[model samples]
Target chain A: MSTTTEAPQVKETTKTVDFKTIIDIKDMDLYYGTYHALKKVNLTIPEKAVTAFIGPSGCGKSTLLRTLNRMNDMIPNTRIEGLVDIAGTDIYSNEVDVETLRKKVGMVFQQANPFPKSIYDNVAYGPRLHGIKNKAQLDEIVEQSLKQAALWNEVKDFLKRSAFSLSGGQQQRLCIARALAVNPEILLMDEATSALDPISTLKIEELTQELKNKYTIVMVTHNMHQAARISDQTVFFLNGEVVEFDQTDKLFSNPSDKRTEDYITGRFG
Target chain B: MNNLFQDANRQQISGRRRNDLIWRILFLGATLFGIVALSALIITIVTDGIARLNPDLFTNYPSRRASASGMKSAIVGSLYMLCLMAPISFVLGVGAAIYLEEYAPKNRFTRLIQLNISTLAGVPSIVYGILGLAIFVRTFGLERSLLSGALTMTLLVLPIIIVASQEAIRAVPRARRDASFALGATKWQTVSRSVLPSAISAIMTGVILALSRAIGETAPLIIIGAATYVAFLPESLFDTFTVMPIQIYNWIARPQEAFQDLAASGIIVLMIMLVIMNVAAIMLRNKYQKNI
Candidate 1:
């Protein structure tokens, strides 16, 4: 891993932390028009691990997540500086294709957004777009994705039913299945369980735990407990800057930064 | 409660109830007036046309003899014109709407174009007839024909369809497009596969309504020189034709009482055609709404 220089406190904190880095953000800054949304944010997300971004509202956690897949490029008058490297390749490089980058990095939104199609079609949508047309192959992929997302048994009998017929939690899982159908390497969930009931939230947390074994997962969450429960590394953000980044257990138990402790202790956010 | 407060409250409640009753009755009378007027019109038309309703109305061509007068050519002409106008306007209007809503940059130019379209929708139908006369008839040398008349109606209703379709396209939530994009679907695939399907029922409803208006229009057709009397149906796009409105107008102008009755019968047929078209539109909307 490349050494993250100074703030002597961060260096002292990282001495006990160890992981194989897969995504490295080096002195990154992002602006939406005149608004500086992220300011010299540096982070290293590890492979096959769940990294959680915990921050108050409007802290730019979601903005940083979107930048990973170049989704920020869709917004008008948005600009980025410095490097965002995924798997040792600079994603913002001129040669990178946004479509191919998105194909490798899947995202789930705060609200479940399933297409207004059949349950089977929802999972099969991504594969179909990439030119997978064989019926048997599509069927296999659909079943595998839904099963992987843990939505197959409930929906397998009625694959032709409209996706809207499913509950909100089921719809979110279907969206997960849809993303997985594309065979992405990294999964980004931006408060994916914030809209769900506690039971559904637990189910998704469990799914995320299972999914992290195969796919590198990064999630931005409002629930600190969720981050504590699922993440291997926890990054605390405040005011468009990273306040703390350490092992999840270490950060919660012995936070290095005062702001991180204050925010996490329900003192102020 | 204090006696004074109770008295005041009771007085206010009774006064408000009295005012509410008066307004309710007034609104009910207004609604009844429209329904009663419409029922009277239908009764009058049905009664007047009942004697003229026969197999001859559908089979025989218009003639000087009132007994032999029929709307065969007019019916065929209207249907053929509708077939041409519906598809043409739907394709053109929806295409323009999609471009404006999905692809066009939001700028002063786009706002100006949108304002122009809204203004165009409110322009007099006869103004479009005059335009058709200058462009399709004189400039293009098409003369007074079915093609010219259909083209005029198409222009007359095109603005309405475009405006309605733009609203429909705009109504599709951005999340659907985002989902499609995140899945690596190209812009075209996202539109055709998701956006269009979601907005289609509304677009079809708008197109069908515009076509209904086109079917009933007479001022533009007359301005474009559609035939008032045609014994034979239009054999080709270039052939002269007469619509039900034009045929009815011709009958109502004559001094003969029998011809006036025939006009009443023609009105009934036109109303039936409109009802059928609207029912089809409603059915299409409901069918697609279920899927969406």
Candidate 2:
């Protein structure tokens, strides 16, 4: 559940009681070619809540996040074991379409990669591929997605300009807008703010808090403060396995596991 | 003792510096040798051909009389061959590159195919001439027509186009493809919408360079039995043809002294056509580059 904030006290009060399990992972294991990338991991993600995955480098947080939408399928010789179900549907089942899964679970990457295209085209790319051809509808989606990412006021007049013309922070926000344009139910952020400056990183954390009301959000972060500030639930990972899963405040204040406590206190990674 | 060691080190340094100076002068001489040879060849060609450069070169067809002979049919025929070869090579070459770079699994078979393509680019044009003669010219019964010659040239330059295009496609960043795929795009959608657009300028540059090689090719056309004296323009794809190189070769072979100037003039025209083609390619590449 989200912690209390003065400005949104009423909204925060309402959000704490309405939580439902949306993603259920049971004994999930993943491998890349013959190397195990993720060990047996089990967790439940609540709908319309922000979850953060915090760990050291090479701890498999990003790998586990990618498996949520089957993005790991793109890698050659990658194998997954056990179940990862979203809304009661097993995503690893043969009948499950990876593309459709990805549409429902949008992802933003560590590096902000705006296609070498106009801003309008970058946002419209997802919808256009999903078969929306109407100019008016595309324009509406582009406008709404940009406004949601808090980038519309800066980019509205020059929609036709190339996306690369923007600064790094703007480009990362543009990537978020691009992911939102598809109307996904879940958003995955894989170190999305690690490439930005402190100010840009703060802006993204604020955005995550605002976005959690409408979408289930999972973020992988090296910055523990950002995770504590934004996420409602926190999962600590170590050596491809989860060390602890608890409410954000409890995990930060009184971690149940010694490793989690060490990591949180900067004793050792 | 320290002074003696220092003196030895300084002696070694001076010796190495002298060796470096010698190698630098030797390398400079080698480069100048090549440049001097090339400039001499250019000067000879220009002096020989400048007086004979006339409008008749574009208006009249080939003739036994050196004064009357012009490169009309040969110029038109080479252009026709280029027009036919460019599209065929671009589609097949770029498609194969995309498949190899984007879709093919990383296995032994793909590696072998890539190795063979690199090897094929090194194979002589004359060998391709033999292959064309055995296949398109005889087996398909197309004979020495424009279509047969174009097909042969396509095979000759196909390897170069494929290799260059593969390099271009491979140069595209992995991040772009990941971003596209993360947005629910299928494989082809990611390639065509994102990857291809970013690499198109490089692809165009490669294709144009390949097409230029195809335009100047003579061995394959000769082996395919393209007629040396086709007076009329090729009205159809099946019509017999002779490209610029073959025409210039014929002129150079003639015993008459005047024919040498005529050959030089043909060379000039051929070079001009190549320049024009390259310029057009650069313009197209620039337009696509701006979009990316």
Candidate 3:
């Protein structure tokens, strides 16, 4: 029965796309203890594009995003099965170091989780860990990362002040700057701006648009308008299955699935 | 209908007033009970121990002559004990607390260890005295030396230090831990840089409080065979020793008025030391809390 349903769908999806895949996921199933959180799923995240995962809460979009960086390995009794290839390297292989993977694929969380340190120190932390020790070099990296995150102007005067002293939006930007300082190739954001007010959300979305030019971005957002506005590609997920994967403009305008159309039209999630 | 409503409202107001009176009475009664108990303790200590305060109390060594003897030897002995015990106990206890609180897995063994430490904290000081006697004095053949006494005191107060340090470490939020780890820090790096700094103030406060308790402990020292009379101060860890509590106990046991006055002076000294330690702990805790 499983083979009967999966054969045609595999054939249908393969025929439509030919993109340079940065991350190739195949037959991935995830479980939180005994509860099946993510069903057998396959996806190909394209290189140098803003790919957004839009789904309701508990739809496994964030879980899937974390899998790209092996962040799910930290959780106890969480099991993952299948192949996840990052740049033709199987990230799940025994030889792959999670630390190196995490360094290459940076993550930003739902809330702004800045270190309880000065703003300069927060940005310099990642670089310092990778053995960049010269003070002048660290300072240069901090400035460039902050500027890239669009937070340099506001925090330039108070680089020595505690990161906790910043406003919410500034703190979020500081967190982004911290991730960028490590010079990762890919950035995964899990509801990165959901905790912020609408203005901050808009700012983060604008920053996301600018960031895709340098780093491949895979973002999980509940905001449909956000997915429509910022993402170059959109993958709609439901019940741990991909409802539709298409260009953001095409998915929002002409959703082929009834569920995707209903979701985009503000029906039940 | 309006008249009925007004009558009900009047009843409700009177009922609330009666309830408030009852609550106020209960609260005042509880406050008075606590005050009376505290006053009784202070009065007993002051009346019994104050008269002993005199110049001779710090001048002469312990002797049979109640009028002439002092606790100079015992004071030296206790100072020596503090010098030996404070650093060793603080390091071991705080290290154990940090390991248990931050690194230990939530397994049955860790839970058992936690429960055992808490139970040890509540155990009578005399039991620790007995343990010290068996382990340090008899088994090791240290034989009523200052080292044995200090080791015993260290054991007696260790649980308190561990509990205090754990509370301090726990007060640091998990968000701090996540932030540190997210910056590519290893577990040890995260704990050392972020968690320990935030927890240091609380840990120091706990150590100071534990040391105060250790200084006041008489039962454990006595059980471990602390001398009541020593002619000279202990010059080494192995030298025979006496502490402030032992000296006071010796003086109070005598049936002479002059000796009782000496005991009161010793009590005054001990109380002053305790107050100073407590004030220092509070100041350190506040300073660190503000910095964090």
Give lDDT: candidate 3, residue A133.
91
Question: What number of backbone clashes does candidate 2 have, counting pairs of residues 3 or more apart or in separate chains?
Answer: 0
- Stretches > 4 Å off in candidate 3: A1-19, B1-5, B43-60, B66-68
What level of docking quality does candidate 3 show? acceptable
lDDT at B259, model 3: 78
- After TM-score superposition, the amount by which residue A70's alpha carbon in candidate 3 deviates from its true location, in angstroms, is 2.6
Query: TM-scores of the models, in the given order?
Result: 0.94, 0.94, 0.88
* lDDT by residue (tens digit), candidate 1, B1-292: 5665655677779999999999999999999999999999999999999899888998999999999999999999999999999988999999999999988988999999999999999999999999999999999999999999888999999999999999999999999988988888888889998899999999999999999998999999999899898999889899999999999999999999999999999999999999999999999999998876
Candidate 1 fraction of reference contacts recovered:
0.74
Residue A228 of model 3 has an lDDT of 90
The digit string of per-residue lDDT tens for model 2 on B3-107 reads 666646777899999999999999999999999998898789989998888999888899989899998999999989988998999999999999999999989
Error of 3 at A217 (Å): 2.2
For residues A5-80, could you state the per-residue lDDT of candidate 3 as single tens digits?
8878786356336446798888999998998888888888887778999988889898899888877776778999
User: Which pairs, if any, clash in model 2?
Assistant: none
DockQ of model 2, rounded to 2 decimals: 0.78
Candidate 2 Cα RMSD after full superposition onto the native fold (Å): 3.1
